[model samples]
Target chain A: MSVVPDSSTDASGVGADPRTGPAPGPSRAARLATRGIPLLVLLVLLASAPLFAAPFTANTLSRILIFALFAVSLDLLVGITGLPSLGHAAYFGVGAYTAGLVSIHWTSAAPVPVLLAAAVGALAAVATGWLAVRSGGVYFLMLTLAIGELVHQLAQSLSSVTGGSNGLFGIPSVRIGGEPLTLAGYVYWYVLAVAVLGFLGLWLVARSPFGATLRGIRDNEPRMRSLGYSPFRYKYLAFVVAGGFAGLAGGLFAALVRIVNPSDAGFTTSALILLAVVLGGAGTLWGPVLGAAVVVLVRDTFGPQLDGHGPLLLGVVFVVAVYVLPRGFAGLAGLVPGRRRSTGGTA
Target chain B: MAGWFDANLVSILNGFAIGSLLFILAVGLSIVFGMMDVLNLAHGAFFLVGSYLAVSFVAGVSWGGFLAALAVAALFGLLAGGVLSGMTEPLARRPILDQALLTLGISLIVAEVLSIIYGNNVRSVPGPPGLDGSVQVAGSTYPTYRLMLIAVGLLLALVVWLVVERTSIGALVRASVADREMVSAMGIDNRKVKFAVLGIGSMLAAVAGVLGAPVYGARPGLDKTILILALVVVVIGGLGSVRGALIGALVIGQVESLGRALLPELASFILFGTLALVLIIRPRGLFAGKVAHS
Candidate 1:
């Protein structure tokens, strides 16, 4: 019923799929060192990216990181918990709009708006989750899709707050230490720092015992229920956490792009995030980061040249990915020798 | 009070027109999902294709052009459905997510390609020549095209009922929906049945697309919007039953148009609230079909 055993062991202590447990015949320290090396190299590369890349490239990379964060959060529900939410972008939009509103009306203290956005996202999840968690499988998928469209329609219709279809513009950049972050390079770093922190926090949650129970529920909800674990409670919690994280990503997105349109909360964005997660391999924590990078870079590179054909190219990518790389980028990456088990649970 | 009565009458007529469109579009989706277990996200793309084809084939106010478009769209739908079914055959036993993603990929491709060809603009095709002008009904002037749509919708619903409930092919489809393995055990050639079900479903969607062109128009975002509405109808009506789809579509259609007219601010709220209520009260839908799978 599942694609692969959600190999969850990770150096960062990200939760591994409980069904598979830890890999045999390998020292934990050995696993840590092997995984840590690549992660360290990647982080260092990201930290120094602006020094080498063009300003536009740096800015684009920042946007990629934001999307990557969104995808990673979604992976928690879809990959680890087996919830196929088609409307995950609702929370992302909630965060973006919240941050945008704050920036427009009051403060641009960077962290404050993002934190508020996360809180708002969590609250929205709680409200929606109350009803959404009642069903499973296809029903859940449809419900999420409905809620997403509802939010999108609201965003479009509520022109005063969302600026309707035109979206809210002129969002001020983050100001740190009472100084405005005017430089393009500083903005990139600010986004990177927040995204990295967001990802790390998710990693910690996935590593916890709570994450393990969620995996158990995904594998067999009935079995878990018999064992006296409330799958509903766990699923609800996962939904809220994922929503909060997605909101953080959205706030960062608004800050990075300086705009939040109704489309940000639409099904298209939700589908794109799902595509990235599936492309990266749902179960792996870091795979979606790679997936986000690929999707964003492909669109950025081809969007201008192709004009209207960008979506066509993306469609082609989705079809090819499904047939050729069902296990996704993380699955392909796993084929490389000497890698430790990574975080991610199967559906 | 008389003005309010006229408004109510108009809303009711409008509801029927929208409901019938929903019925035609969603019935196919319901059957395919129930019998084939393949949730073709690309179903909406077929609707878009039908609309676009109608625009090209339709000469101003000509029934011949509309018929031609319908025939071509059905042929296209059959070919597309068959190809997709073949591709999806291997993944039948795989996870639903994999299947959904694959189909979603197909939808994305079709939608993008269409946009590229047609551009991202709303293009309309006029209704048949006979139904071009307004007709007076109950002291209110209404579009003749809309009334025609209502008539055709009711006729199609009747035809669908007769075909599904009274025909031999219907028997096979019902049996297959009940138990695929059992039908195959009875030597019914489940593969052919499956293909037929998918093909017919696709054809129905395209037909509705052609018929609905005048009312909804053809556009870039139409696919997603129609897909969502169809999904809502299917969910509300029940998964596998034909009667369920009819009732579900009509209710949603009425609620959407009437609700929008009655309370603009709370229109979406009321519409979505209905879905939420259905999920809470009867997760299987108002007319829960027999094809209930875990």
Candidate 2:
């Protein structure tokens, strides 16, 4: 009779199930070769990307990387923690606006605005998360939607500060060691570095004991409560952490784009990010990055080609992806016959 | 005080008119969610479809044409709802998120198609000829159409209340909402009930779209705007309760219309602020029904 889906049977194997006990351990060297090699290769390729790519290509890649960070942060909530937030853009926009303002009125140092944005994003989460975390499931989704719309309204009405509908303009390029990185290649390098670092931080957290507790709660909240864990505190902390990273991504986005607008924190952005997480595979950390790339390429890179029917195309993607790829693109790993069992451990 | 009342009377009446319109849009959404755990994100798209139908059918704003438009919109909603029900059927055992995404996708496609046909212009329908004029009320002149809208909304509300509260069909719906398993155990086909509810609910949204065309107009992004408003109303009133939808719509209507007149800068904030405050104080909403089960 329970309407809630069975989380344990989820093919994507996002978070480790408490009931299944710990997964069998891979040998240390074996784990390194399996996980480390591809990551190393990817890093090398991305680092060398700006060397050969055009300026526009570098910029688009930077956007993909920024959104990858954003999508990963949201994955921490929707995929790992099992909280379906529809208003995550609130924190992202807050971070972007904060970074933009910091760059405009204060120093444009790369880390200063980015770090401050993360802090502000976490603070915003604290302000809104306490009330939101009180409810779970669809109610949580509605509350977040309201909070998101509230922030969007604030951005629209606080004309003097947010520049109203026109958004915050005149944002200077990010500076490194007292030199502005004005070129797209240099900006992409900076974005790559920050995104890599942010992704690593989230990756570590997802593998931590805290992350296990979140997965446990997601699977069965009442059981978690019975085991003397306060689901509220854990969810609130996860929300703040996710918000901080989303803000970091937003900060990098503002640095890359050099502007902050209301649409950055609007519902459409939130929906798109959520779609990215779902499309990529909810529980897998890296899957959403792939999803974000597809989303950005489709909406921005190729959307104009079909007479601006990008949304139409995206709509079709959503429908098809839901039915065809339930566990998302990451879940595709589980589809390969013999790889099914192994994908449960690594996917 | 008298001057303030005189100045704001129109806004108050406008609130009632808007509330009625919102009730028509939201009651179906609420009930459908309550009965079937499907939050049809495309509810707004259905409404837009109705509005666009009005734009086409009510060409000269004649009374007969308007009635025909309403009838057509209702039939279209029923057919669309049936399709949506079938589309979402396979995902019934999945997470609400899946259903949400599926409906959102449907809505996007519908909106895109409509925009393609309508050219994204803000096309508005005029009221049927007799109701197109204005009349003096208190110290201000009010649109005759709005008064009619208010009366029609109340009449519809009354009819809906009678059907839900007094009829055997309403008992089945209420029973299903209260306990889906028990209803099925009692030899009822839950899927059939869900289909009927979704169809009726969508029809309400479509009919409201046609009814509200003169006030809100048919526009490209209007679906999203109306969807958000309806979500707010549904949240405030409590999900799945007819009385709650009415009360929530009325409350939101005042908060929106009166808030704008009283504090333009914080008008939108007031609406969401009320939502936040309500969630904080009473997370289940003003008149939470028994149907909300996570």
Candidate 3:
């Protein structure tokens, strides 16, 4: 019944597989031109976006950045750690709710709510991750899904706290040093700053030694175990960190949208983020971010114009992407000029 | 004790009624996963299709009309299942998640198409004229349709059990579940078996949808709700086991009804709490079949 080949073989071949392996050495100038220059250019464009773009366009871009962070956080578990979670929005929703409640009842101070959201998100992950990490593969997916649904139910039933299906509304705009960031451009800048930090944190974790250990576990748990690494501990930590980042994204989301609803933490949100991760390429950090942008554009921007048939288009994308873009947009990196084609096909 | 029984008797019966409906829906999911290694996420969409068909063809109609609706829904489900099976066949060599996502996509499209046709309003199907009225049961008034539902569910369960446990074709299905390679080695076309299982499983889901229409009503999100419930039933009962599906569905049914009656505040969490508890104790479920090789 098992379709997966032996883990040993998979681990041995990982280095040769272009999708999972590090690129062969390139000169510093070439690397600078290929990676650094494009990243810098993109950052500059994003920084200047609100200056030139319309208010509506700026607002939509903020949403994309928030979800891009959310998707990248998911990539930590799914792409790097080899754990495909379907309920990640649980933490994201928890973070959003925390931010909303804090902003409403305590302080609208921007950093305070966002920080608390991240902390609470980590706590929620620790609470659920212990049980979820016990199982692997599809079972893990199902367990996380159940956990997500439970959170959604809690959000719905705990009306006094979460405001129930009506959602928690009337949240004040986030304040910076006692002044509210009311304008769309100001809010966009705030969101972009936080999102970039969250992305960098996740990117660092993915490149760190700990991240490599996670990749080891994903490729072959038994080998890692024999090498004296506790797979569970590493996996649990990754899940917590990812949850924290997801929460950070959620906090950003609440600040931008000023409303937190049950659907924010529901299965649909979780599934959409998962689809983004897959569509962008699971393990590629930047790929999922791109996927998130596409997904957000399709559902939020183009959806209204399509007579609310955005989901139909999304569904078609899910099917078509799985079949045609198995490696996602990240897999097309080799097609660029002056880039060497990666050895081997799909992993 | 008698007073309490009188007060909660309706809830208990409601449990059975819902349990029977769940069994019909989940058995197909359980067995298909076991035999074909495919998790048909579109199972709920199939159920939704049936409920809508019930709304269109069975509501306010005669008994013959309701029966004809069931036949039509079943046939439609079979065809849908066949197409799904074919779509998923090529992805067999890939990860199971691919198949899951594909089915999810199909379900999304189906749901979108359905909502477009039926609108977002909640549409309830009424029982046939003869079965629509209330009848006395143990000194309490109850809907006659529910009692009939219980009887029908029990009869269907028996038929399924007998077919799976006592018949030759059932043996083939069991064998296929245990070891597809060995069954294929014996010259059986595993693909045909898979196709049949998918078709039959889908048919069962649609039939349950029609049966559950009066109780659940046809709505936009009903498909997702039913799908989640069926998934829970399958998980608790042990995937791919008909007997497991029966026990799991009944257990969840009672939990759902009794929880709502007893602790309305925690009603939603009760079912998932049970699932978590089960996972902690026996992650493979209560009646897990032989552990398939990973």
The candidate that wins on DockQ is: 1
Per-residue lDDT over A1-347 for candidate 1, one digit per residue giving the tens place of the 0 to 100 score: 11232345544444354555555545766866787888899999999999989999889999899999999999999877878788999999999999999988999986988998899988999999877777666777777888888888889988977899999999998889889887778999999999999998888677767777777777778899999999999999999999999999999998889999998999888988988988887767778888988888887898779984666777778888878877688778664233322222122
Each model's TM-score for chain A is: 0.92, 0.91, 0.90
lDDT of 1 at A93: 98
Using TM-score as the yardstick, the better of models 1 and 2 is 1
Cα lDDT computed for each candidate against the true fold: 0.83, 0.86, 0.84
Residue ranges of candidate 3 with Cα displaced over 4 Å? A1-23, A27-33, A335-347
**lDDT per residue, candidate 2, B252-280, as tens digits?**
98899999889999888788778888878
Tell me the deviation in Å of residue B102 in model 2.
0.5
lDDT-better candidate, 1 vs 3: 3
The lDDT, on a scale of 0 to 1, for candidate 2 is 0.86
Error of model 3, residue B3, in angstroms: 4.0
Give each candidate's interface RMSD in Å.
4.1, 6.5, 5.6
- List the candidates' TM-scores in order: 0.95, 0.94, 0.93
lDDT tens per residue, model 2, A1-347: 12223343222234445566434556556766877888899999999999999999999999999999999999999888888888999999999999999999999987999999999999999998888888666777777877787788789889999899998999999999999999999999999999999998887777766777787777677898999999989999999999999999999989999989998998778888888988888868888999999999999977899688778888888899889988778778653222111110100
lDDT of 1: 0.83
Stretches of candidate 1 above 4 Å error? A1-15, A335-347, B1-3
TM-score of candidate 1 relative to the true fold: 0.95
lDDT of residue B284 for candidate 2: 81
